[model samples]
Target: MRKILATHPLHPRATAMLAGAGRLAVASALDPKTLTTEARDADIVIVRAPLPPELFQGAANLRAAIRHGAGLDMIPVEAATAAGVLVANVPAVNARSVAEHVMFAALALLRRFRVMDRDLRAKGWLAGREHANSTSELAGKTIGIVGLGAVGQAVGHIAAHGFDLNVVATTRSLRPAPERVGFLSIDALVEQSDVIVLCCPLTAETRGLISRERIARMKPGALLINVSRGPVVDDEALIEALREGRIGGAALDVFSVQPLPPNHPYFGFDNVIVTPHMAGITEESMMRMGVGAAGEALLVLAGKLPVNLRNPEVIEHYRRRFPAGD
Candidate 1:
């Protein structure tokens, strides 16, 4: 059987499909040494952890690196293309789950639930009840989205139609947005929005999209929510804003670093809601992503390109390598 490797343990649904097609192997750890060794014999890799460029050099048999989720940042696209490996991702499959997570965090932050619960546990009902009057509601607020991808658009749909909130979005695409969502420049959206949500990808241009100065431009006491990649917002800048109380609060589902380090400053801030990059993870979404990724893997195995192929240029080299197939 063709060898299939995964960076992490696969959901049972995905495991079943992969095993039926190939001899499945999952990495015990994500270190470079382990991955490099494991990838050397792999014909296909299902990626969850970041794949290094050097690993591609050793993966002589690797025909494809399939992403379990929407983002492709984990895989080095240029190196994969150079190595004749097809890169694929399942987009929009988890949009609803991520959008729902954004809404959940936004509501929790606006209502000051973190602080209230902390005080309620520490100083009893009186202390907690005191925070009751300082909360805000979601209705009638304008939500500005940094990106207009599947997750961003899903968030807009819910915020506009379900919550009765005005939605404004920024997108490089010239296509007009839905009637309910007004397309605006990032600067204009920052100034007018009551809630700012980041759902953009992590690119060089977007690495520090929400810089210190960008946060300064927000309406005073406006809330910020990040359901996108962590580096999209400047962590240091965000922390300072929360410390100074310049902004109302923030809900961050992703971060520049994983595990976030024990006793991080974010842990001490009641105004900041820190999640371990789980905005796209839900039981339902997991199944969808697993099935989507497995289906794509199967297609590539059968000498067919993925329907959601991220790097099409790799196909020319791929066809040369798999001459007998495609």
Candidate 2:
């Protein structure tokens, strides 16, 4: 039987989908050391957790590494391609979940829900009601989105239709222009928008995309939300901005560092909302992603290419290793 290893367990429904293909193995935890050992003899790796690039060094039996989610930053594509292994990811499966998360953060910050609840518990009901006059509504605010892909599109739909908010978006694709959202350059969008949401992928050109200079361009008191990768925004610059009160407030779902150190400055800020990179997780999205990953794994094992293949150049060596009809 082929060795099928999962960095973490997939949904039972997805396991059933792959039951007929091969034997399944799982890591004890989602840590680096555990994943490296579990991935040792895997013919196929279902990546639910971030893995080390060194895992592919002597992986002669590895046929494919499939990401359970859209982001490939968690999986090192360069090392996999160099090892002649196929890399694939399931995209757009968690768009709705992340988009809803952005909306939740926006409203929570605008309405000062955390502060109000804290005062009511610590002091009295009157102290909480005293701050009710400061709350703002979502309607009529201009929302700027970075990267108008699946998640951005979903956010635009809700901002425009459900909340009656004005929507503006920046994208790499410009000719056709994404529908239902006005197109603008990043600088212009930041200047005009009341809120900015980042859903862009992290890349060489995009790392530290939001620097001090860019942060200075933002409309005063404009809220910022990031559901994208952490390195895209300069953490130090953002912290400085938040501390100086140059930027109004921020809701961060992803960070440059994981677990964000217990005494991190972000933890002390009332204007900032931090989450443990779970914006893309929901019951429905988990089901869709698990099912999608299983289907791609089965395809690769059957000597066929995955529909969401990230590295096509690996095919030349891959076919030579495991021919179509072996």
Cα-based lDDT for every prediction: 0.90, 0.90
TM for every model, in the order presented, reads 0.97, 0.97
Candidate 1 lDDT over 1-326, as tens digits, reads 79889887778898888777888888979988999899998989999999989989988889999999999989999999999999999999999999999899989988889989989999999999999899999999999998999999999999998999999999878877886999999989988999999999988889999988888899988999998888988889889988998999889888888868978998888888988888889899999998888999999888788999999988879888887554
- Give the per-residue lDDT digits (tens) of candidate 2, residues 186-242: 889988999999999998878998888898888878999999889989888888888
C-alpha RMSD (angstroms) for model 1: 1.2
Model 2 residue 50 CA deviation in Å: 2.2
TM-score computed on alpha carbons, candidate 2: 0.97
Model 2 poorest 10 in a row by lDDT: 172-181
What is every candidate's alpha-carbon RMSD to the true fold? 1.2, 1.3
Q: What lDDT score is found at residue 134 in candidate 1?
A: 91
Task: State the lDDT at 142 in candidate 2.
Answer: 98
Off by over 4 Å in 1: none
Candidate 2 lDDT at 246 equals 88
Error of 2 at 203 (Å): 0.4
